[model samples]
Target: MDNYSVKKLSKLAGVSVRTLHLYDKMGLLKPSVRTEARYRLYGEKELLRLQQILFYRELDFPLKEIGAILDDPAFDIVQALEGHKKALLARRERINTLVGTIEKTLVTLKNNTMLQVEDLYEGISPEKVQAWRTEAMAKWGKETVLEAEENLRSFSKEEMDGLKTELNDNITARLTALMHTDPKGPEVQELIARRYQIILRLTGGQIKMEKLEYFRKLGELYVEDNRYTPVNGMPSMELALFIKEATDHYVSEQKK
Candidate 1:
């Protein structure tokens, strides 16, 4: 097996030597060999581990949690890579949707034209969207509700449709597929954690993911009142319960 010095491996991995040292310090990545001068020497195994580290980092995983995950006894490199592919693909779709929204918003601004209400929310009824505005205005002051509507002006009809597709077809579909898995499992928790941020954005920060009880309450809203039924591609009680239980577990873990 080829062995590389710390500096050499750093250059190869596009990471700083100091970063490698920090990883070593955190017990996240350890070199396999030591030279006569007690210098760090990394092998192929280290290279693969570093690759995994970078992959999780790209997914916004914290370094400490990444270490815990990588060191888990049940960790499987092949499985992890497959999960990474799915997550990255989902993220790419969201990014593409946002970019399209931005482009459309620019065009609308330049033309000084506005999208029709029916087109703004393509799949859903315009009246329903208007009802949502009215309800939001009642719950949270009118200014906040108006500001949230103003933000939606940036999304084109197609981008609005893409957001719906991404949420239902991509995120929800994947979560439904994992419904058979343990809610407390890494895959389930990780997926739900990402979904939490999406929910905050969807609500225009009107619903904060700040408190544990509030966070779990949103999940409860899924099955109880079908409050999120409109946007979540719902009617699956099992999937809704899975999300509720999973988010509850995730919130518990976060507190720890």
Candidate 2:
């Protein structure tokens, strides 16, 4: 039977020898054979186990969890591989969409041309946008929602890009930074006030004092919607909640 020494296995597996030793220490993986010289050697069975460990690692499974799963008597290698394939395919689809969005953004930048509404919201699904629009209309009335959408559409590509950049770099950055701070603090409230102004601008200054509640509701939607939870490529439910709290605080202050 063919066997591999620790050094050989490390080279074959593209993992460091120290890593293999650590895995052995952790009882996560162990060589199948120990020679008279106390040298560790891995056989075919150990190779297969190492493959399984790497597969689990690729899926971002915790080392302890992977060890538990692999050591489970009911664990089926074939089923695990099949599940991994499905997850990888889904991840690939999302990556492709983000790539397309980036390409469109690049083209708009290179040509200095206006982007269509769809292009502006490139990676977001039209169905999702429509669903949000429907919900907005139901809550705020058709005229309010349509007017907001029209106002957004009226912007040139450069203006639209600038607005997105400001949201990401200014508003989102500040909100994310203050995630650990008190949401009702002066700094957070100031940021929330700026965010409210930006929203009003997006709505062509249509938002009035009476419609301020809409801004607070919009903050809630940021937490409730998975799409809005990710800002500037980072996902943080905490940040979304922080924004919602700050908006609520801002609105409460307005009432006083």
Q: Which portions of model 1 show Cα errors greater than 4 Å?
A: 1-115, 199-231, 234-256
132-212 per-residue lDDT for model 2 (tens digits):
557656765677554444555655556556666777788777776665566546675555556665555544555566555
Q: Model 2: which residue pairs collide?
A: none
Ten residues in a row with the worst lDDT in model 1? Answer: 234-243
Best by lDDT: 2
* lDDT by residue for model 1 (50-118), tens: 998998888776798689778997867577667877978999999999999998778776434323434
Candidate 1, position 34, lDDT: 74
Residue 176 in candidate 1, Cα distance off native in Å = 2.4
Error of 2 at 238 (Å): 20
Each candidate's number of clashing pairs is 0, 0
What is the Cα-based TM-score of model 2? 0.35
